[model samples]
Target: MNKSTYITAENPMSATFRYLAISIMFMFVGFLFGKLFVPASLVYAANIFVVILIVGLLIFSLMSRKNVIPTSFSMNFVYLFTFVDGILMYPILTYYLYDLGTSLFINIVLSTCVIFAVFAFISHKKPAGYFIGLGNILLTSLMVLLAMTIVNIFFNAPVFNILVSAFGIILFSAYILYDVSTLKHYIESGRITCKNDLSIHVLNLYLDFVNILLDLLRIVSDLKD
Candidate 1:
């Protein structure tokens, strides 16, 4: 099919790019703040920052009638939500599950398998349908991860924390690839149409980078322990 077939009234690529740049700037600022202060405190602070970011984006979406935001922008936004859900929620939840020891790794493997399996099942669908489906899956997965994390806080343990972190690295890495591919397809196929779409693009990109940071933090934290 021709690329123009997917073009909507909204063009999100430009806006998505701008959002991605802004997010990167925030990351640097957050990083520097962490170095100057307590590392753990910085993480917690970032958690709050991410939550605020989500609210801001949602408001932006609600304000704009057209969802023509760039794929990159939406991708970053998705990435950010993943970070808030994963980093802010998972470790604490797994703290209790840590008592489950290496068993928690099973959770990681299972979740990863399920996510990829779902992706594979629908990858061949129409681009719009495929993305919408994928987004729903990721969102659902985050919900599960969040629940587990909340539970972990009260039941804090060390071993489970390690497992969760390791798994997060792998899972988020896979998502980075998945998200990048989706963005490329959307842009190349002319699937993006409006400001809302652009927001989605930025959201995904933010999610990818933020998740990577979270994974890295877990890796480092575990090693230090």
Candidate 2:
């Protein structure tokens, strides 16, 4: 396979890389559009609708006969989902920009990339299924985190807030490892040979990366304040 080409089943690793790259690219596109092209209100206004669209598309993609991926719809919807997520992040990022300026944003970006790389490296070096067994625990952790977030809206305790952010970092870091380990399983087992499978994996890692960055940003800002 050429260094630069669409990933086919023949080269699953390359395909995975390509899909991840596309995921990151779409995220950047959405963030840039949100930052430069329009106000956050527009995206905020479309938030509910976009969420519906994202969910609908996800269901449709999964159910469609074309779900094997390499199908246009699968690829397109993957991009669309990430793009929308980036747009949704606009307000939060914008606020950070205003409060902490560009330096924090840049540092967070670098931190995310480095953290992902380190975790990915570790995942690759480890045996397959290393983190796969943690799937249930990971899900439970997220649910617990979500519940805490909602509760914090009312309590607003400083100690609790810091703990939440710290937990966010740990959870997402584990997630990156989990996702990568799962990707290895998928490729080796020939379970997710198509683009759809790759896209789903990419989405998982992309989300993990995004959350980790957000958590890191929050931690840094908290320290500064």
Candidate 3:
């Protein structure tokens, strides 16, 4: 309910990961609820709603970053944001689950977990400075990726899309390292003294994992086609 409830000096990493795990569980629940209860006809509306939620979360995050919002409030917002994200993923889940089959879908989920764990472990073992220094380079690459994505929207070339997906995977993988390392540094340096500080890192890792999974799915689907 508050900073002291979740985080402590003795085991900050444990507490952060515990919260992250819970957020992932909420996401799965949202995904199942969407798949079973929500109609596919609402997919377009869901997408629009998700975009609005994203924008709202961005604003909320900025306010929280400035220490204007309470840690407890921000923590609740993280769960809500992740749940909405899971609901938004319903269409993608349906495509992989129904169209690609259960086995392949399971494989994709397992692969995503494996990839996420590997990078997280790598970041843990390295010096925080190693990943912190990569911040600007990664940001610049992301901008370029965004530009290419926008161009591909107009051209819509199959090969170009494949290239973009590949780039996205690499970029987001690096992001996982950067995010994890940065958070580790924050925890060590006493920068993350409250629950509110963890919210952004949780969201960052969530986005990184999901983006990698989606991009991997795109690449595999393209290869199969």
Candidate 4:
């Protein structure tokens, strides 16, 4: 194979895997820092700043130089996002970690990995566009769920809470499928340039993984209670 072809085709899946690993590692790093070093108040304040900064950085990166970002700068953004995210999640993770124990956290991690692997395999085998329709449906469901969540804050509906968690589990699982499917399509179609915009997919998968784990944790904790 020519150098360019090899560069493009040689283990496209590697990008996906690398991004996933980095994401998980950063998440853990953030989790530890948040849990041990940062207070809730500081994390809350930093949360707002980090989120805006990360989003702005991502947008700028995508818009510049054929959608390619400098590795150094991109890495910095990734680290910052994870560190801040960890800090933000510390309070919630602390609650569940204490109530549910570390074992449950491990279980959720393993479970999410397996589930994502299965979907990745499917995405590799299946053609793209298959999940687009389902993704749209899930997106709509997510929107309504968000609305309901806002309402629940004031209404404090127990049933609605369980329903949201259940639906969140399903929605995020489908998101994994959609994202993997989308990733495969973009890689093949030359839209995503796995080398350049891999961060985009990484962020997408990380969000899916975290959301699924959180929802699963919620359901399991409720059942245990």
Candidate 5:
């Protein structure tokens, strides 16, 4: 339950499980939110909500950089908001899950693969933290996601869509492991001390849940069809 317990390297197994549990819980909340608001207007509401959340995250990150804000509160907010972002992203992904086909799915998979590859490369060199290459990775990932989304407008392939959902499950699950491991490593090594470190831990849990939920959703969708 404590944030510190979630990132201690000395207890990776426990931490990993805890991290996964956190992800699962948040994912369920996201799913519930999606289910409760199942309507055309949900998409618009989600879009506006995500936009505001992103703006707030940006503003906080900016202020924190200047050391103008309290680290504890700022970091806690970061963790909380990032969790919300991760939860909200599910609806957006859900909206597109069945709408995209093979080509677009392939594009999304390839894009994600490239992002992981880049993250792997950067981490090998730095092996310190995601923040080191966060800006570049985030930008490139967004570009690829946008490109894939745009291409979907031209071609909608059901087979590919299913595959994308499957891959998303795998990719995001692996990310969960990696994120949890690194977080634990950081804590054990005395790299992370402040509560702000919780932001990154929470973010990792959020991504894990998102992908796991996507995988589950895809399975359900397939069974239904």
Candidate 6:
């Protein structure tokens, strides 16, 4: 299929959102499959698989960004990756669902949606360049956060974990604003001229939403403890 078959300059935003919706749907399907069919005994193995998949996807995304990979292929990869990711989320989701109960789980999801929507709206109103400039600062913060996470693994301190989770919430919240603005800039500047480019934006938004949900979940769990 032609690269531009689904996307057009006039309505790139709509096309991107459509792709995002589809990706999220695939993730939900994967989550259900994992929750229902997968044995709890395999959760550890699933975590290993997910870690490897994440690394692979990161490499693939880098290649796609450099235009070394075909856009069509990259788009398909995004969907598959998202599905696997959702399946892997089974363990964490169940923990939260069971521990917090159905109502609280729903509330957490609603809160995530609200946070995502607010940042997206803010991005829409701001000039893309403003958020684009934040790219470096966010990346630096992310690296520092990763280092802290690694250190916490050894110490396993509750206070440290809480601090990291709090930092993560702030970092990823900024990321949502940056990513949404970047997507808007890409569409407006004609950088996203094909359907394939939409995959990256879909993945970015998905990660942003998921990360924020996770950080919120951790915080809530800590509070409960």
The candidate maximizing TM-score is: 6
Off by over 4 Å in 5: 1-75, 78-150
Residue pairs clashing, model 4: none
Off by over 4 Å in 4: 1-6, 40-76
Instruction: Give every collision pair in model 3.
Output: none
Off by over 4 Å in 2: 1-10, 40-73
Tell me the spans in candidate 3 whose CA falls farther than 4 Å from its real position. Answer: 1-10, 42-73
TM-scores of the candidates in the order shown: 0.48, 0.78, 0.82, 0.77, 0.47, 0.84
Better of 4 and 5 by TM-score: 4
List pairs with backbone clashes in candidate 2. none
What is the lDDT of every predicted structure here? 0.47, 0.68, 0.72, 0.64, 0.48, 0.72
Query: Tens-digit lDDT track for model 3 on 1-225?
Result: 555544554466676678888888888988988888888876545423432433343344334334465533476777887788788777666665665678997898899999999999999898865698888787777767666766765676778878987897898788888888988888778677677777778877776777677767767776777
Clashes of each: 54, 0, 0, 0, 2, 0
For candidate 2, the lDDT comes to 0.68
Whichever of 1 and 6 has more TM-score, that candidate is 6
Encode model 5's per-residue lDDT on 48-96: one tens digit a residue. 3433433343343334333465433444354345446555665555454
Candidate 6 residues 50-162, lDDT tens each?
A: 33433343344334334575544466777897798788788767767776789998899989889888988888899875688888787777767766766765675778878
Predicted structure 3: lDDT: 0.72
* Candidate 6 runs further than 4 Å off: 1-10, 42-73
Q: Which of the predicted structures, 1 or 4, would earn the higher TM-score when compared with the native?
A: 4
Expressed as tens digits, the lDDT of each residue in 21-42 for candidate 1 is: 6755555454344345434444
